[model samples]
Target: MAQLLKRTHMCGVLRAENAGEKVVLNGWIAKQRDKGGIIFADLRDKTGIVQLTFDEGVPEDVFSLAQTLRGEYVIGAAGTVRERSAKNPDLPTGDIEILVEKLVIYSKAETPPIYIKDDDNVDDNLRLKYRYLDLRKLKMQRNLSFRHRIAKVTRDYFDQNGFTEVETPMLVRSTPEGARDYLVPSRVNRGQFYALPQSPQLFKQLLMVGGTDRYIQIVKCFRDEDLRADRQPEFTQIDMEMSFVDVDDVLAIQEGYLATLFREVMGVEIQLPLPRLTWDEAMERYGSDKPDTRFGFELKCLNQIPCVKDTEFMVFRNALDNGGDVRGICIDGGSKAFSRKDIDKLTEQTKAYGAKGVIWIRKEEDGYKSSVNKFFAPEQLAEITEVFDAQAGDLILIVADKPKVVFDSLGFLRRHIAGLLGLLDNKQFNLLWVVDFPMFEMDDEDGTMKAMHHPFTHPKEEDIPMLDTDPLSVKADAYDIVLNGVELGGGSIRIHDSELQAKMFDILGISKEESQKKFGFLLEAFRYGTPPHGGIAYGLDRMVMLLAGESSIREVMAFPKNQNAQCMVSDAPNAVDTAQLAELGIGLCDE
Candidate 1:
């Protein structure tokens, strides 16, 4: 049976003001120190730790019982608080120590496989295996607490704004729009399965049809796609929707939420309405859709350069004649940092992303030096350097290829170079909206046009007519919220008109029968008079990771799966009994 007495004070609450008061404390033993007749143990709870001393003055039995205590032993102590002679200013409860008059050992624990300290150097896989103990670490505790605070604040903010928190169905029909679905086989309905939602996109739109004006939910979404460092098989999204909202209205509410969140979470005051960057400007300036504007290595297009009129370097001239682009970036003070060998390494890195070769230019005290200089005279190098305002210590890196390859390869190199130079400011967050995204992109493998976002994303009203004539020039009403070059979330106004939706399907090569087969229910719902609505879904796990200042979501999660989406703690997604599968009329096919 457990002790009848409940805890009167927390481990961190017995300060100098409560020095002479009697208090009952309950916690796990953090550390035990023995000093002849006196034994001191640091008792720790979720709040913090406090020192508990069992002395020879009052109870000899208590002092002897304290000697048996070890790390992580759960105990209940009734003690009188006293000021310590030598106060340890490092701890919050350092000024006062608890003098125990009673001690009750609630539970005895075996030595933990991993240390409970914050700085324990255990392997990550081992940590995941012993995740319960890993979560006992102070960092994980703080992370969970911070996440709760943010969630509470978010809910309150949306609620106050007349947004009704609503839930959508998780088990629905599968539609191949984005990531692969996680399907669940049903025993009651044999040969049928329900797919977990990648997002509540269609349901939320149906909510608009049902006249649920504003809907919000901190919902869990699942996808059966391959995971990356920043992705998970299942994750939470701050899903929201609203009726009669334009792009500006959505941005305004989000901006207000950001201002409050940054102020409360990080204690940083953010200015209202973060900057906006167009797709064309963002790609041309930073060679990325989500540009990191924290530093200043902007991509420079050399279409204006006049030195390649009769150059022997066909790479440069051919790119211009073939309707491709020549772009470069000036790395500040890289003339000395990158040796010839280092430049060769950089060239190899870009080649992975499909660049044929890299052009290197070093501005020296003598004259302009370049890898392609043997093919061009000093005068040509001077003309190229002058275009980029190259100083004596600057290094210019150029890529001459198709516009797509040039942007992709050089953009990757720019980020790599920035990391090598430690140009990212960890303390600074550059948030911006990358607006006016292209409606469709040509799939290289299939040579077919695919939606940049989802197919349901509505094209700009002005571009609606262009769908029939010039589909490539159309822009969607999509907006991506990017934080320091990482895309945090993206959304767009959805197609509400059945006529326009049919037209969109035609453009995407979705036949009438195919569209009806996949999205007939959604089209049927749209016929019930849907309102003009749009919403955004932010990755809640990633957002909390950013707020907690952690590198990955695993740190913020209590029991997270590894990169392969395997649960080390519970050993989930394991093989079940063959009889159970047979009962469901399912057979395992050999790969």
Candidate 2:
């Protein structure tokens, strides 16, 4: 017969209040020290860590077993909680010590390759490879726990607001209009494949048409796109959709959901009805649709500045003459923060975003120094200073290029400067809603109109007439919720009217047969009286990453792919047997 060991308390839960109380605890031995006559072990669980003492009072056999413990060995100890002589203020259960009388080794573990500490500076590849051991660290455990709490809070809040959690199929037809899909081969249906969903988009819309008024799903979405710190090939989305709701209705519900989430998970109260900005205003002022309003260093178009158009500086003159933009941002105290060499590095950074070069003006004690001082006279320099409202010890960085390049380059530079200045506060959470985006944006390579959000996004009712005449002038009833500078997620009031949907497809160069072939079912469903629906999908991983104060979504995800979209731990995307491929009517192609 096997002996069963029962746990009466977590390793970190016993405190001075529980002094002299008998308790049984089970956890991994974080660290152990033997002081000749006594042994002390720091036992750790998911909650936290507590000290266990094995002295002469303990049974000789139990004390002998406890002294043999190593860093991550799974063990259980039965003991009485007592006030510690040397209490640790850093830990929660630091005030108490467990006088362990009974000890049992549940399992033994080899020494971990990486130290199980929050500040362990191991290589990310090693961390991912030994993710199971990495997750034993307190920080990683808390992040996953926080993720769980957020998911629970989201489900509860949406359910209370009359939303049903309906599941959608994972394997579906490939719609390669947006991000590249991760296709799965179909063995039964030879030569055909099913692509994993980028989002539960069409199915949720179909649900709305089927009279499922309010739908919510915590679902996985796949995308074979480039990876980043905040992105993964496969991720979870807190997706929701509703019928007969406009922009305001969807925004209000989401605001309520977020408010509840913050209160429950973070214990921080967020003010209802977050700040809102229109797409044009956001882009014009901040040079970005997703603006980080945490700090100030807003972009100012130099077209409005006096003497800019009249200046002999060919950079500004040629830009204004050729219908390009000249924009500048005033970085306070940047004169000292960024040296000349640092400014050159920033100039190189801007080139990556399509800018020819960046012009920098430093406000000195006497007057001003500029990269293009030879082109502008002292009086013209003073005018430039006045335009940017420059004070002594400030730096004005300017970019002159086509509208998109100017915006992209300056926008990225602004954030980079903020990071250099240490002005971005991780503790401060700024939520914003950017609305009224253009219905279509011109693809730089092909010069063809592409849907700004997606083809399903409805054009502003008043701008429907301009779909064929001037598609670029049309605005979509779309909105994006931005946190700090990262875009959390976005959605738009979908085109429920069949004619409007067809017109949108036509504008995007989707012919009748192409539309039928790609989204024929969606079009067919829309013909059955679809409601005016709108909803948003929040990147659950990104949301948790922000909430947990992590720099990457991988910190919050259990198993994630590396930059190359390869799973180092599992070694996935491996070769399959030839018989399996042959049975599926698939053949390998020569590289």
> Per model, how many backbone clashes are there?
0, 0
Candidate 1 Cα lDDT to native: 0.88
True lDDT of residue 107, candidate 1: 94
Find the candidate with the highest lDDT and give its number. Answer: 2
- Judge candidate 2 against the unseen true structure and give its global Cα lDDT, from 0 to 1: 0.91
lDDT score of residue 31 within candidate 1? 97
Error of 1 at 182 (Å): 0.6
- Model 2, span 88-207: residue lDDT tens: 999999899999988999888998899998899999999999998889888988998899999999999999999999999999999965789999999889899999999999999999
Listed in order, each prediction's TM-score against the native is: 0.95, 0.98
Candidate 1 root-mean-square deviation in Å: 1.9
lDDT tens string, model 1, 135-246? 8777888899898888998898899889999989988999985789999888999888999999998898889889999999999999888876678888999999888888
lDDT of 2 at 88: 94
Candidate 2: worst-modelled 10 consecutive residues by lDDT: 1-10
